[model samples]
Target: MTVSVRALRPGNRSDAEAFARIRMLALPYVFFTADSVEHLTARLHPDAHFTALLAEDDGEAIGTAQLSLAHESPEPGQALLNVHVRPDRTGRGAGTALVQAGEELLAGLGAHKVFSWVLDEPADRVFAERRGYRPGSTAQFLLLDLAKAELPPVPAPPPGVELRTAADFADDPRPLFELDAECTADEPGDVDHRLGDYGAWLEETWRHPLLRHDLTTVAVADGRPVAFTAVRTDGGVRYGTGMTGTARAHRGRGLAKLVKADSLHRARAAGFTEAHTGNDAGNEPMLAVNRWLGYRVCAREVQHVRELG
Candidate 1:
């Protein structure tokens, strides 16, 4: 059986569906949708050189890869080649083929380094190592059985603070954008992402299909957004926090916990039976917060990096 890999056909409904399906099957912990996949590939910045690659075994897509440069990073030549093969189709050559196409594209784009996320499982680790990639930081995929987990009671916002949803900022989201920019800048990760392009953020994140603005909670102080727990839903019973953080000025006021708890409670009330979120293993503060929310670790993934001359 010969496996052929090529760039995804943008605006093709079948391509988007196949890519999203393979992603959901291979990485069940995360949420994805065909619309989101199409939106990302269509709206990506030109400098990123983003390509959604598909590996086909006998004309059927069995592996998917998202190749692109980390354009927002201050570092030069930083690229990503994240490959995920359908679990049942792993033994075939599709994974390798997809990876080769990704690396070739990145190298052609003058990338000096490439990063990927591999499942912490032995086979995934081995596959990455065999490709000359070295393991770096680890992150956990956590799940909370909202129907059974004992959630802490939502607390009232402190004096001069109010609880609101991301929907409240539809008129003008620059405040939320500023808060996201600050918090994301301080995140602990192998790659540094600075959300400097507000217009890009609006197109790529704010208007994203999976973003549940109605359920995303924000804490405002003195009529300004301060902390937030951005939420995403799979249009099913599953819900996940896309990003949760507090502004630098509001760190110790328990706003992070407050917004997260409020969001989870609302998620459950709205019939979302399962809640999911991820955190870097080194983020002790967030780990503590999730523990308080009754989230248990379900899976772990490690970052793999390879340097190129």
Candidate 2:
């Protein structure tokens, strides 16, 4: 059978479904859905030049690649290409073909450096290294058995503070958007991102299919959201924490922990049986919070970076 890589057709439901399926199978820790895939293809910023590619052997989609520039980052020429091949079809040439196609597209788009996440496994590491990518930082995917694990009791907010849900911002989410921007700026990663564009955030995040606004818990103080734990549920039994953070002034008050615990409880109450989240190895405070919530390291993925000359 021959493998070929081509751009994804947004109008085709099967193509979108296949792409989401491979992503879920290869990276189950993260949340994905066909609708989310379609939203991404249709709504990404024009400057991002986002391109989703699929690798097909004969007529079956065996691998998928997501390529795009880090448009929100101040530093230009930074791009990302994440390729995942179906587990059962790994021995074939799908991955190689997809990666090559993805890299070529990004390079042509003037991306000077490319970053990718590879599962922290022998074969995966070797594959990236063989392609001239060097290992960088690592992240851990933690899982909690919501049905069987005992979660810490939801802690009451400090004086003048109250626990709220993302749903509370239904009438106007701009404040939550501001809080998200502040917290995202401090998130650990190689690229420094600025979420200054409200329209982009609305299209990319607020409207995301997996975003469980009702399950997301926020800490409100003085009529403003000071801390929050964003929730993403796979329309199934699985739930994931998209992010948990406290605003700059609210740090050191344990608000992050408080919000995350509240969100987890809501997720369990909403019928989610399992939960997953990821953290950079160096983020100790959040790691501690996850441990307190009974999340254990289920897998690890290493960030790999390649500088194109």
Tens digits of per-residue lDDT, candidate 1, 1-309, equal: 889998888689999999999999999888888988998898878889989999999998999999899989999899998999999998998888888889988999999899999999999999999999999999999999999988999877888999999999999999999999999999999999999988998988899999999999999988999999999999889999978999998898889899999999999999999999999999999999999999999999999999976
Query: Model 1's lDDT to the true fold?
Result: 0.93
Candidate 2 C-alpha lDDT tens digits along 168-226: 89889999999999999999988888999998888888888889888888899999999
- TM-score to native of every candidate shown: 0.98, 0.98
- On the 0 to 100 scale, the lDDT of residue 17 in model 2 is 93
Error of 2 at 148 (Å): 0.6
> Which runs in model 1 stand beyond 4 Å of their true positions?
none
